[model samples]
Target: MRSPFVQLLTARRFAPLFVTQFLGAFNDNLLKASLGIFVTYRLAEQSGLGASSLVMLAGGLFITPFFLFSGASGTLADRTDKATIARWVKLAEIGIMGLGAWGLWQQSIPLLLAALFGLGTHSTVFGPIKYALLPQHLGADELVAGNALIEAGTFLAILLGTILGGSVVLFDRGALVVGGVGVGCAIAGWITSRQIPPAPASVGPDAPRPRLLRDSLDVVQYVTSQSKLLLPALAVSWFWLFGATVVSGLPVLAKDVLFANEQVVTLMLALFAIGVGVGSILAERLLHGEVSARHVPLGGCVMAFCAVDLYLGSLGRPRATELAGAATFLREPGSWRILADLVGLAAGGGLFTVPLYAILQHESEPSHRARVIAANNIINALAMTVAAVVAAALLARGMTMGELLGLCGVATIPVIVITAWIVRRGLMKGVVRLVLRVLYRVEVDGLEHVRAALPHAVIAAN
Candidate 1:
């Protein structure tokens, strides 16, 4: 069989879709990161709110739309041709970026908040379309590779965006520069979307587009009806939730616990993102184009273990001066341990997430795929909201970032245990049986092929 990477490249439909998805992710993060930095540094001076509070507010403004609009967006994706939806979504991004540009020019916090909300809305509307479009464009066998590439692209984009955002804020006219870059990225994403092949609507012409609440209920009902789909979808949602907690808490952890500056914080984030990207792409290679649904439980186990390790890594606070350059940070005894923990956490996150996404796409019905993705987005937003509230509360209660990390680590154990139990109950026997059957079949094929190559050889069908 051809290699997974080769197979992925050979597929006519995948390259354009990959580019479209990657650029979309890149632009989304570029804008979000730039806006986040602006709120944290520039807007705080005008609004009189502390940087942390403003950052939290910016996060809320960005995520709230997912909760409010994902259902509608999902339904829209199902009802329309995905290519058309993608085009429209990219157009919407351009308009949203325009608002962001205006906000940046005015240096208005209110305007920025409004622009953020608009961006959030744009993302919410695109969520279902993005996920649902994949099944239409790719074969079942390509799902894993597709998801891996998408994940890799996403994390890499995040790394670049975070770097750019932080770097821009140090410049004299940072907002304008960042805003211009964000606009350009959005436009580039739109150009990529235009190259995507036409994907016909999976939903019927007569498919009922219900009211928002009704549509959400129907989508939930539809998703839950398929056990394989529901479980993985929930797992994917949880992954995002966990990710949100870690990412949102990083600045606090770096500054308060490690006594680090922004550069150090950025380094930690970049390392984590790079680790995740590596792991995600590696999964595709390891799986070799096969459905590796069985890996999900293993990934969960690793995630739980690494989360606890991260807590342990955070136990002892570093000395104030230790948090300097990357070289110095790496040379420190404790820093190596922390870096190891971060890598473990990121790798486990990739393993846990990439498979779940592949599973969700593989198992969900095409007709309702977008709605299911919308549901996933809704849950992700809810999880992020909860994480924000909880993190804020913990911080307010005089808990250090290290202690909060410990609590999250402790909490992850039960979560992983429960999820593993559920997955095992559903998938274990079937997977074991399939493995045994494949082994037996492989041996039989080997013997038959050997006989077939010999002179006057007889082949056995059995």
Candidate 2:
């Protein structure tokens, strides 16, 4: 644990929120993974659906709520106290998991899917509360670290919950075990949320009752109304699109392209998660806790190049009769190249996202911040859903997975350019600042000149 993380974790204001967020993330993934395995292994035959279809459906079920109900959820978060909403969401989790548990034990697919949707709604509502509360709880100096840690914790939680869900659900008593764990985490989340210091509603109580489509549009317009805020929102959405494409494709990429076994899927997942975690912490250190996107351009560049490497490295790989296990995959020198590229791709995520989120939290109006984040969440979910659809369509059209991923890389340059230009009103300026910030650690007033002037000095290049 880093010294600052230890301090924040031990402190009252941040620790409870942190723990609550972690448990919620863990619980969501845990159920999703359990349901995926349950549907695939247990019901594949009777359901008459392919593994991919069922699994993808399960994933979509988890995300559907965010797209559908974020309008109402975001409004609710702003009108009511955020901590109160967190507690209520956590409490709802317990009930949701209880239904999921019954569904698991009874092997009822519909019940399980319903609970899954319920869980998605729980997250949709909680999502706004989580990011919006950061500014209220932590000081400006701590924003980067706070967002970084959350991102790191979230990815790690997803990794661990996924592993546990996939592992435990294979047991004869898997249903009982998965259910118990979900309920336990939910209970703990509720308890932890209680300890969260009060964050009173910033929006007045007279706010109109949410009209789903209208409220969502208003929130999105609010986010895009500020030229600067649009960048973080768009950049965050793009990252999720890229991320969803990578993660969803990885299973097929591992089995079909790399001809690797199931454990290899787990291995690739760990590398990506750990890479993001490390990159997030590194971002905090480099920026010295200042909220800025100084490194975002560099992060996008790294992802672009590394994604191209992934496409190139995947070429001409030998096919195996039996999928290569993780051990065999690691033994090959060529595998190292693929692994490195995946890490770089994922690390770029942590680098760009932590700062952008910190910037969003720091810059938005306190009253409407939750709605803006809600809009971002909706955009992220929609973009990710699009990634899944596009990958499936292209793969069906005989596009190689490598070509598809390479397209993601090629597509990134424009996103970077457009977002950089929109956010900073200059593209080359962001790159120059990133370069300067990296090359020189020179102090101005004992603080690096990068942050507080995100695209500052543009180094006079552009």
**lDDT (C-alpha, whole model) for all candidates:** 0.74, 0.86
Best by lDDT: 2
List clashing residue pairs in candidate 1.
none
Candidates in order, TM-scores: namely 0.88, 0.92
The C-alpha local distance difference test score for the whole of candidate 2 amounts to 0.86
Model 2 vs truth, CA RMSD: 3.7
lDDT computed for candidate 1: 0.74
Q: Residue 359 of candidate 1: its Cα lDDT?
A: 76
lDDT of 1 by residue, 1-462 (tens): 666656665665676666666666666666677767777767787788898777778778888877677787888888888778788888888887788778877878787778788878877887787677777777766777878877877787777877786677547888778778878877887887777778887878898774676776667777778787777777777777777777767888877776676777788888789778777876676565555555666666666677677767767765675556666656656877777777777777787788778777777777777888988777677776777788878789898777776666666676677666776754676566578778765322354356446786766665
* Superposed model 1: Cα runs more than 4 Å off: 6-12, 48-50, 321-323, 422-462
